[model samples]
Target: MKRLRLYFALFFILLAVPIVILLSHTYSNLEQESFFLYRRTAESLMATVYQRLQENLLVEEQRPYTHYRYIHVADRAVPQQEGLNLSPLADFPVQSKIPGILGYFQIDPDGSFHSPLLPDKDPAIAVPQREERQEMKDKLATLLEGLFSLTPGLQAQLDELKLEESPPTAKKNSSNFRDNLESRVDITLEQRYEREASESTYRLGSKEDPKTDSLQRRVQKSSLRQAEIFDSQLKDAYSQDLEKAKESAAPQRADDAPDSRVVAGQTNRAFQMGDELRSQDKDVLSEPEAEPEVVAEVDPFQSEVIDNRWLVFYRKVWPQQRRYIQGFAASLPEFLESHLDAAFLNSALPETASYLVFHQGELLEPTPAGQNNPRPLLLHSAALPYPLNDFDLAITVAQLPQSPAHQLVTFLALFLSVLFLGGFLGVYRLTVKQMELAQKKSDFVSAVSHELKTPLTAIRMYGEVLMEGWVEEEKKEGYYQQIHDESVRLSRLIQNVLTLAELERSEWQINLTTVQPVEFVAQITERLSNQVKRAGFEFETVSEGEVKPIQVDTDALTQILINLIDNAIKFSKDAETKKIVLTASQLGNDCYIRVRDFGPGIPSRKLKSIFEKFYRIDNEMTRTTRGTGIGLSLVKMLADAMGAHVDVANRQPGTEFSLRF
Candidate 1:
């Protein structure tokens, strides 16, 4: 038994080890797979956010410079003036697609401050005409001042503009507005007209601003290098595009025309017709031709983050010899929230992770998750594009979510573990039951052999003594009685064994007959009365309450009664009050026959399993009783075959076996 148990334990361990290892391996793989899937999603979301920012920035970059100022028939100072003019930008709310814009401003090469909100001052214009404009200009300047005061970089830039606008000496007023305006008019109307009429190109920046120290301070070494590289590339691409556009727009050459003479003839005819009309109408006058506009050289825009909360976008413009800085200012937090946060929430990224923006190692405000303690499971970082250069974007996930495949694997593992353990447990229980049954059967064989041998040996000894004439005359009758009782007991034992075999093999046929319950009881008791008396026990019978007739097989019922009586006599033969009660009664719809013995009652906990085949209350090794265990088993089987039920219960002083029909 110990060896068998050891083998079972080893087998269980072998089976469980592989299953546990397999589950562990599967879990590890699933974890890695989930992380990989989340990482890819984070990467995709970051790329999408960057692309959206670039698209919006492209829109801001393409805005024309003319949008910053107001257009007028002439300058705002001379409303009645016949010439066209440009005025300062109005102080009304700025209309822009970008969010959080404060205002727009410009800085001249000499650091003079100029805003689209503030118009150029003129001594000729009346105060009434410029009153409303001056009010808006003052409000805009005050707003700018308040914003700049909070930002160090903005404050410095504003101070530089103020320094540039101030003259070095008192005599410099002669070279101020009036002379500057005249010089601009001479360059545009006189010198430019002459250069154009002479068919000669006037190069931009032919006159350089004498002040170089201030410009150097304003532009950093790295920023200048970047600007030069970017501007050069931009110009080359622009030139290629322009050449392609011009070639597409240029008129076809006469040599290339399919019918050059036809085209020439049509042109001549139109000219002749125009001349005739002009001759007929003497009052007609020719309109003056418009002059070709000269394009200025504008540098790419550059961005500066001020105090980590403000953003300044500025670009340098070189028109002739004078340099101007044109740009706008905005709240950095509002810009990122309006642009990046919305894009992130709308993307697939937020489903599994969050993001943070950092500029020069400083974290930007309005973080997605709004928490900073949790460690990120997956992190992806990328630098922003130009203008927002040096800014870093990080996508983080506090805990990576389980993927569908991982969830599926987990469910399957649980199911498999349950199934495997359940099967193993079932096999273990079945094997234990089989081993127990085998042990019981072995004990039954030894018991039956001893029972048969004792009876046969007694009968043989008495018969041998009578044949040898060795018995005294007075004891001869006692010897005969002894031999007859032993023969009856031996015959009964063989009959019980044979009946049990027939019942197990399904060869035991039951013939049913109707018999009165009282008569049935009387006949069963009469048949077993001698056997009980021989065992030296007093037996009694009782009938009650108009017992009904029962449908049963008399032979099978008789065998059932004999087994019960024999069991009672065997177990209680040594009791202090050796008595048995055979009862017949009608209780409700059923008729019952009971055989009760005055012996130690069966234990309560073992009551239910006592009727099982080969089950005995006493262990075979220490048993003092003299019967095989098959007596009660045979009684239960015979009763069941007759369509009756058997029940066992403990009486006050003994055990009762009932057969209900």
Candidate 2:
């Protein structure tokens, strides 16, 4: 029972060794496969993120307002009204909010815009100032109104003239009146009259003050005439300015010249309208041209929308956005509150609470949340951080299943582990069984040798006594023959038992020496010829090649030859003329020895196991041979010890045993 337990323990250990090795190798391969799977998943996620952002930006770019609404407000002169305020527009709902917009402001009294969010004392507010030249033009027109109001009647007459029909002639007439009025208007009134009868007499004393009265009347008439001319000239000048402003304010037309041209008819009509206003005693500044107010330019690099709420602004945002994305990628949260699928999050985050974020093909760090650290939020550039802007959009990638290669590797590892364990267990059990059988065979051989030795000794002693003339002379002949035959049989049995013992112990030794191949064959034939003839067999010896000395054990060779010749003699039952042939040949550095006999050949299936101990064909001829089965087994063991090989094969009519040394 203890031996059995030991054997079982050894078997399990032997089985476990290879199983452990296989399992370790399998596990390593699985880890590598898993790593590759992770890398592939990361790469795919990055690609998805990049693609989604790009698509969103493209869709956003296609909108009409995106191209038109990128206004830059640089200076802020008033703190209360700056940034992107839409509250001042009464038509806009008070509760309405715009994403990404910071604040708004109107141009201040100091000709600058200011943000209400920023302090009034901020120094960036005081930059280069714009002069507001349009406002100045309005104030100038108000100052000139009284001076131009006097020409109401003349202005009516000028308005009746078709300025658009002949603008050059009207301009010339108006210019002449301007020159005359500039020369005549004065703060002090003086009259100069042409005198006709002055030569007759010196002036009489006491002339009335005609110059004051007549000068006042003439001044009033001149002022009215000059005002009409001034009005017409001012109207023409204002119309020209209006045309220039309209041209400047007009959106760029497809085929318009680099320098835009104004239509002459339009300019003339504008002037005529101004002239009509002058006839009503009103000062008319050129009408401000109507312009389509452009708010901002669409950001082309922005991404498109995936779902309606998400705005993906891929690479289109500012350089700061690039930095933000890089940082965000470096710190992905294990958990996220996004509208993305829950399964995606669960699969992506490992049980160890590890999650990876990738952006644009790069891996990122995760943002940690704790007692002091709040979660860092990612926002679009168009939308400022929370409390500054709002958005209902998010971005995330779905986790994919394990790849086929990974699964295959895992399965292969498991399969190999099982195979290795099973094979080890089988080998271990077989080895133990073989060892136990060998031990039992050894013990049996020891007991059999003891039993056989005593009886054989007693028989040989009695037969020798009879042969030494202790019986009658006629009886002595038969006794001597019987003694010789009995002694031979006993010696064979003893030799077989000893050979078996030596083979079992693996202690069979060979002393190699060089001997002539022909001499060796001759000696063995001469010694075994009598036995063969007695057994009714014809013996032949064949030799080839020069009589060269070959390296071999003479004693072992003698035993091998004796066994083959004896077996051939005993087993050659089918031949009418029983014959045994011993042949020797040399090829290169090796020698070949063959023993052939015209005998009933070994059966095909038994041939393989014929060299095993006690193994023999179960047939009538073999049972009558009276032979122990150790002969061929000894032959094989001796051949192996001598570094030579022996084999048997069926000849055409019999059997052959061949040895290569």
Candidate 3:
């Protein structure tokens, strides 16, 4: 049974150690997995956000310029003459007879390009001089009258051509009567012709007052054909100038310098001057002038060259603009609303969902507009870089539900494994101790049986011999004595075995008697004295402290003392001075009896187990000693039954066994 228990304990211990080690490793892996998942989710979310931003920017870039029709231009317009200051232009009516012309112009002539005109504001108006205004009014009336006088068929043709052609009737009404008097109706035709010739010469750059000459020639021209041709050319030139102005008002190229051009609806004064210069070659010049007229290049398209305005909306803006952009971005929330859940889904681990956006390197911190008027988070299929030029952004979203419980389970598993291992080890150590004790008991039992059988066999043999009359009468007496001693030893062994068995079964009861300590010691000494003397040992007894009687079983007390004395005597057989001493003393309410032997003492290693069942000091002296080994074990049990303690200690010369009752 002891061997089976030892094997069972060893098997359990072997299993428990590995289980504890495995549990610890599993717990560590769980923690690492949690962290890895979090990092991966964060990175994925960042990529999604960056892609959305990039897509939005691309869409805005693809939008056409015609959709945003309002032109942004400079605020000031320069005049034709160097010192001539001009007021800002009036707001022109956007509704025009022409279907596509939305009449508005930005005129910044001085080229101070700071302020931009918003599309919402009216076109600037310039204050004109009264004389210039009257002149403009007369010219406009003449042009309107001519337009109205055209025949319906001609007007249809003109409309088809989309040409602003002046009618002949209006020109004929403005002609002079000098050419009509040619049919023998002119008495001073020569004088009139010479005056007309002189005025033409003056008009043709003869250095004689060109303004007066031009006015005279206009009054002198009586032919309706000449007047019609001049009016038609002037109107064509004026219309062409307007078209050029409109073209110039559009956005310019990147490298163009700002220069003045004829304002829309303004008279082409430069064209008029050039026309008068050209007339000098038509029999109108009397002499060539030393200097030629300086004709400026009149590109009406130059003023229309508009530069594009690049507005970058950063985090901060004017309150109005800030409010506008915020509202604009806010309006997109519904478009992006469905993507929030998708972001969570994309996270590989639940706890990682919270850190998802942070891992996306392209995601940026929320701008003021984004914060104040947030848009729903949107996910995109591709990744792009965030436009955070200065600082990095780290954002945390909702908490993730990682399986902490699972991790906890791992920890608990490890803890349980360790506990199981410890339990197994404890059971194994206890089993080993129990098995050792059992083996000793078995050996003791076998030895005791052999020892008992030897004495009993001797007694039986002697009886048988006596029955056979195999010895002399004197020899028979000696044989009977030997038989008597053997019988006593056999009886003692049987009594020890019975007492031990009772103690094991928890049935041993102490029958108390008030026995004097000194008497008890002396009686045990006298009983063991014959054996001690035969073994060449001296026996002595000492009593101290007015030795009082102790309450104990007389037989049990005597047995305990006798066993200790016998053991001492046996072990002291080869000692130089073989002496056994029995002593008793009164200590408070207890009595102590000590048996001392001047013999080889018990070994130090065997001292602790000396009182255990069948435990013997493993030495040559003890091996040779005739003992069942259960004697001291029985002594301990009997002492315990009497409420006494049995202890042994090595003296300087030998060993001492003491019992306190």
How does each model score on TM-score?
0.65, 0.44, 0.48
By the TM-score metric, which is better: model 1 or model 3?
1
Candidate 2, superposed: residue stretches over 4 Å from native? 1-256, 259-426, 432-436, 439-478, 499-509, 573-577, 619-624
lDDT of 2 at 228: 28
Q: On residues 1-661, what C-alpha lDDT tens digit does candidate 1 reach at each position? A: 6777888889989989998898888876676555445545655665565566667666655554443433222212232322223332333465555678766776544444556553332122112224544555554455445433322235345434442442112111112333322321222322323433234321111223232112322212222222322232222333433333333333554334333223323322332343354458565568744433333455556677777767877766543323456777777888777766676677665454666666654556636553533445434445565556556665666565677877888888889878878887888778877887787787788788989999899999999999999999999998998998889888888998899899999998888899997887887778777877877898899997989888998888887888888888878877777999999999999999999999888899998877777777888898888887888888888988988999999988888999999
Candidates arranged by lDDT, highest first: 1, 3, 2
Error of 2 at 401 (Å): 9.5
Better of 1 and 2 by lDDT: 1
**Cand. 2 Cα-lDDT:** 0.45
Worst 10 residues of 3 by lDDT: 320-329
Model 3: per-residue Cα lDDT over 72-126, one tens digit each: 1112223443211111222222222212222222111111111111221212211
Cα lDDT for residue 511, candidate 1: 89
Highest TM-score: give the candidate number. Answer: 1
The C-alpha lDDT values of all candidates are: 0.62, 0.45, 0.47
Residues 509-616, model 2: lDDT tens digits: 778999888888998889877667767788899987864677898988888888877778767855765989999998887788999998778889888987876555
* Model 1 weakest lDDT span, ten residues long: 166-175
